[model samples]
Target: MKTIGVIGGMSWESSTEYYRLLNRHAKARLGGHHNARSLMLTVDFAPIEANQRAGNWTALGDQLADAARQLERGGADLVILATNTMHRVYESIEQAIDVPFLHIADPTGNALRAAGITRVGLLGTRYTMEQTFYTGRLSERYDLETLIPNEAERADVHRIIYDELCHGNVNDASRAVYQRVIDELAARGAQAVILGCTEITLLIKPEDSALPVFDTTALHAQAAVDWAIEPV
Candidate 1:
């Protein structure tokens, strides 16, 4: 078995999910008590969020890359960033670490492609939806086109993420908001939707969507667990 490295605590909300899903998947795969062998580097979220507010990603990237390298030193075979927004500096993090970084976009793109979907709607942090790194990686690297909610709708998306999800509050009203986003995406010709933020699966699921939904967090973590448990 290989050790999976997790670069988490971007909000601790989604990172917690990553930790749980990895273990649950490993247990299901290997046995009742089986769990993944892992190394975790949890960075402070306050400062990262502050950096996001200030648009000072250089320092943030430096900090995240350092964490990645430390995880490698701690014996991680692969690194999972655990949050979609943090992937803005993914290339820098990858260059700093020795282990292969499991890109959230790859499995997602592969899954969407396998399902033969050409266009997908995306919902996440304003940064994840509006920013280039995440969506660009999916488009440029994976050859997938992503449709994001319009400008005014994005504030609502950001609110749902921070005001509710970041605090672990899942409500029916929030689900309704997400459902509306999904519907709007479908109306606009999106064949599917991607939950680009890790914590979003807690709010809206495929069950609530008319279109296919890609839960990037789940896909990314599942791949990590598979790598962690595969025989060396």
Candidate 2:
């Protein structure tokens, strides 16, 4: 198995899921107590969050690039940024590492395409929703149409992610709020909802929404495993 390097702990909450899913999927696929060969570099999210709030993407990119470099030095064959929002710095991270930097959006787009999902609803941090880095890639690469909640709903979604979900606090009220947002997106012609935030899967499940839910976390992890186990 190839070593999968992870840039994680944008919030340890979601990073934990990435680690767990990687191991679980590997074990299931390989059988007989097999597990993933992985390396993880977890950073302090406080400063990263502060920089994000301040719109200091240059500094954020530098921080993430440093982490990716560390993973590469540690013998990682492929790197993954565990958070969706942090993928804004993907280019810098890619440049910092000699290994393959598997983009989170690529697998999500591929999964959506394989499912014949042409339009989908996106829920993530405000930066991810408002910026072109993510949605633009999806449109350009997969011919997918992305729909985001309106300003008001977007604020709520962002709040719930940072304030509650990142802290590992799951509230029924928050789930209800997300459900309403999903309903609005479906009304707007979304065939499925993309859980754009890595922590989002902790709250919303496929059964939670009326439409099919595309989970970027699972898709990204699965893609890594597929790459790791591919015939040489």
Which residue runs of candidate 1 sit more than 4 Å off their true CA positions?
none
Candidate 2, run of 10 with poorest lDDT? 223-232
Estimate every model's Cα lDDT from 0 to 1: 0.87, 0.94
The pairs that clash in candidate 1 are: none
What's the TM-score of every candidate structure?
0.95, 0.98
Q: How close is candidate 1 to the true structure, as a TM-score?
A: 0.95
Best by lDDT: 2
Worst 10 residues of 1 by lDDT: 223-232
lDDT of 1 by residue, 94-199 (tens): 8998778888888898888899888889998988898888888778866888899998889999988988898889999989988888889999999999998998
Model 1 CA RMSD to the hidden true structure, in angstroms: 1.5
